[model samples]
Target: MDRVVLSFGDSLLRSSDVSLLDPPRWLNDNVIGFAFEFLAASLSPPLSERVAFLSPEVSQFTKCCRDEAAAFLEPLALPCKDLILLPVNDNSGPEAGGSHWSLLAYVRRPPGFLHYDSAPGTNAHHARLMARNLSALLEGDGGFREERAPAQHNGYDCGMYVVCVAEALCEQHLRGCDDLILQSITPQYVTRKRAEWKDVIGELSRKSAVAPQP
Candidate 1:
């Protein structure tokens, strides 16, 4: 049986999930969702109230249909958010049904969805579909624009690119950057960022173990 290795907010990573951090292994939804949770928790006031980091399940679920989108997303109160970060997958499902992963973020500043796909155009359709769903909720009309992102040299690194680019964007926003039009992603940068995941998760786990529950 798989044991839980880390739990942060509503996200949980199993023992097997840690193996996905190994070289050439694709990062599954759990890790991405956990990263989103951690990032949201670390944001300061104002930004914290304006930004939202959605989980893979919530993002995927809204893709079903319009009625479902309204019923599901309305409760989340996404319209009031200035920025929303979502990890996109080629296939629409809560499970690891997609063969590829990408990052789709919506910024209310200029009012457009930004897609960062390491596999280039691999997950564009998925990004557009979900972006449309979010768009209708936010402003009733808009389209996704592909942002420059690091291209993965290998198939499995696409997932890491999503995490890395998402981190880069959030880092920029935290540092007082106004727009998501920044680009610093490179193969070497991904390497340095990806190398930190194991230690990051370990530290998070250690902290969770000692924290007082609500």
Candidate 2:
């Protein structure tokens, strides 16, 4: 069956431009380059036809300004056979307390669940808490089933954990089967990583096909 892959994420999921302020640092080139390459290879034919991406602009997806996002998505009558990728971009901008790092918006890094140092008790902190709470809810749901997708672990970094949890929350909300693929974004956020993600997604797709659909 065909599916829609609604990737509502941050700049990492979007096409990024290199920062001129930081010359000799080819961040965008490498990051976006790898992401696209990976996406291209992963979504070839059977899978590509099964999915369509629905990512909106910045203000629509930010932590403080996600009312529009909520409204927009609330009415999106998407097919049951779809995937959701929420790459928290909590580390983006000077407000989020990370001036140097740009995040994939909803994508998160599970490092002991720390809040943004600059904005204590802010909306971003609350949003992270909400996501964490939602993850726990999905993990304990009696009606929903769980499938352990490939874990993208590198050393002690638990970045992939955030993605995996988000996918679980989304699946529960959508009342869909728990079949997802998780991947981490390099600091630069390139397109080639999409190809890498696609490889992982391909594995999940095959597995999901055999699993009972929710």
Instruction: Report the Cα lDDT for residue 127, model 2.
Output: 40
Residue-level lDDT of model 2, residues 76-128, one tens digit each, is 33222233233233343313222121112221221122222112222344345
Regions of candidate 2 where Cα sits further than 4 Å from its true position: 1-62, 74-81, 91-214
In order of appearance, the predictions have TM-scores of 0.88, 0.31
How much is 121 displaced in model 2, in angstroms? Answer: 16
**Candidate 1 per-residue C-alpha lDDT over 164-207 given as tens digits, one digit per residue, 9 for 90 to 100:** 77767876654566544345667676667666887788887787
> How good is model 1 by TM-score?
0.88
lDDT on C-alpha atoms for all candidate structures: 0.77, 0.31
Cα lDDT for residue 123, candidate 1: 84
lDDT for residue 38 in candidate 2, whole number 0-100? 39
